[model samples]
Target: MGSTRIAVVVASTGRPEELGRWKEHILRQTLQPSRFVFAVVKPSDLPSSDAMLPCAEVVYCNPGLPVQRNAALELLLGATHIIAFFDDDYVPSAYCLEGIVDFFQRHSAVVAVNGSLLADGINTAGIPYEEAIALVDANDRNGKPEAKVICSLDGLYGCNMVYRSAAIGAERFDENLPLYAWQEDIDFAARVGRRGGLALTTAFAGVHQGVKAARLAGVRLGYSQIANPVYLMRKGTLSFKAGIRLIARNLVMNHVRAFKPEPWIDRRGRCKGNWIGILDLVIGRDHPKNILSIRQ
Candidate 1:
């Protein structure tokens, strides 16, 4: 098996306490990564030192998910063969990296692998793994032995996915997707797949501590879920039918039912606005905005 140098990129905006927990989980991993990099958005917000963890590198960058991811990607580029993306709220299983390395080694054609996201069962703050599983698309079920499955265009969620550094090349998360909430992963995955890469989902998992979505300028940003997919679809990421299905599913199943009535109405309105944005994207009306600008 090839010696795959793994770089775990933890992108965060705030929550030093959660970072500490994540750090603990990383340090205890059975298959240690070559390097562990925590890319924090606002450095001043994090603890001055997480000295407990060895070989830990922390980077602070402008407060955007794409920008933070790009910063981590740049730092990790030449240093590792496989780069795994993990969010700040996640605490990975001890075997997460080991499973990734083994999967990649055994499945040479796989360009990316996604892990299951379990909710912390103890807290009212987090969604339980069972609940999270209920949220997955029925068609995108995981198979044994890391076999390739037909994933929907919207299948690649960012919370726990690994990418081949070489296949990614200089391509980074779309900077124009200013809102960190939604379709960036779908867009990135589509780009990778279109370029002859495959993304796989595995039973191996990680735990999300159930943090609320980050706020932008005191208001919780919902653009990614509301707008980004529409933008992505207009950009030709998904077929017309797939795009309609995604929007319908979000509107009927995920958004309206899950959110409060008032916020749901407001978010629905925003989603409507994105239809126009989608048209604009297609007809060349407004250029896409930078992802960093949307972060508070």
Candidate 2:
């Protein structure tokens, strides 16, 4: 295949050490990307020159994941053809780019592809090398050839997904939800799929070092897990019927997993924030801001 410019966008905040490890993994990739960009909440929060990855262009954000992602997209717009996004704590395989590039070339209709993510805790040194190697190899074995649009009502995961620059155009992560994480991927992917874009799952994968939520501001990491999907549903990106199904499934699973101590946590929070978000929509709260964030 020709040298397609692929941009890897890493939206990070408060994980300098994990970011350093991810940088090393990117440097060691078998099929190097045409370009790499690191989108951070604060460039000053990043490490010194010695710790930073060579050739990585860093862009600062306003302490929000969607904001950081949008900034990264804006910066990489003209320079890259494929935009691959990863979390700060995930380390990709050496062949990650190669596999994604191959899939894009082979599937002309595919607009996005997500690599499998294996959850590994923070102590990488504690994990045996063989185990890590096996996790990477597992992705290679799971590779499948298929062409279809992913339209699950719940939407896609942002951790290890790649997107087509042209298909997305000026569309970007919605900033209305405002939390630093969650549901943004699902919102974007649902829009893309509705607009005739295809999202695929590939064998090339990465290992996510499950960085503890307590490390970064105790920002209620799982709150978005409950909020974002509901916000999307109320906004009409996800149908009400489908939204109900999705919520039901999530509630059941959370119960099985015993999500939080109180069963009424989600119910209560949704009653508060979702109603306000809906009213905000009716009264035109921050609509201009939302529109501006997506402007090309």
Candidate 3:
């Protein structure tokens, strides 16, 4: 696949530094994209050309991960054969784009592919750029050899996934899913999976650089933890049992971890939010949109 055949879409909000780091990584890719589209919630926050790595078309969209991504998709219409979405905070390997194009070329039946994370943990935002690269290098040294492909994943990781344009026609990310759109990628990828196949690959890779400081307020994320899964279950994207498992795991972890909070996580705040969500659910008010109405 030629560089002209792929387009890269990045959805970002208020995290200029991380986005810059990601842009540098993308600009250094072995296989460059035909176009780079950066979507930000506030148009004013879009980086000027002088600060950008290359000529990227910056777009303004409402503040939601899925909504921003869909905005990028609109601009990319008919522009490329493949569309790849990367979180603004992730630092993908140099061969990431090359691996994506290669896999799609080799597997005509596959609609999407998720790149593996070099690190076991997600919070790499505070690490220096040089150290972050070193960490990925360290992981690669001790990590298992890269696999050509892994079969049968339910969906793509939102952080690093690529899709064939033809397979994704008319399908857009669920806008109803609010900020961060927790699990929106899973819902969208499951739709793609139903049309064809979905797989993950070690050959394609990235580091999440979670960017805890840029994350949603602890309470918002906490509420989403419980409310979002239930919402997905209600929408048929997640089974009831699966939703229960997700909620239970989060509730338990938040409760337990609050006692021994990790520096990278706001465990107590999340736990408080979890209980608030549960209380809301019990009172027949578990909808996610209700979050905006609540006073923090």
Strongest candidate by TM-score: 3
Query: How far in Å is the alpha carbon of 250 misplaced in model 1?
Result: 3.3
**Candidate 2 off by > 4 Å:** 118-134, 137-154, 214-227, 249-296
Clashing pairs in 1: 175-291, 178-291
lDDT of the candidates, in the order given: 0.63, 0.64, 0.79
| Most accurate candidate by lDDT | 3
Ten contiguous residues minimizing lDDT sum, candidate 2: 214-223
lDDT of candidate 3 vs native? 0.79
Report the candidate with higher lDDT, 1 versus 3. Answer: 3
lDDT of 2 by residue, 1-296 (tens): 45788888887777676677666777767678777878887666576778888888888878777888899888888778889988776767777887777777776776777765565554333334356656766654655323233342235667777887877887888877564555578778777655444554543667765555413221132334344555777777767786667656654544454434343233334333333434555665523133223211
Q: Candidate 3 on 1-296: residue-level lDDT in tens?
A: 55548988889888776666656776667778888888998855566556686668888878888889999999986878999998876777777778778778777788888888765335423545566687666654553335468766887788888899888889999987777788899889988777788888766776776666567777777888888888888888787888899899989988888988888788888887788889998999898776665555
- lDDT of model 3, residue 63: 88
Lowest-sum lDDT 10-residue window in model 3: 119-128
Candidate 3: which pairs clash?
A: none
Distance from true location, Cα of 111 in model 3, Å: 0.6
**Which wins on TM-score, candidate 2 or candidate 3?**
3
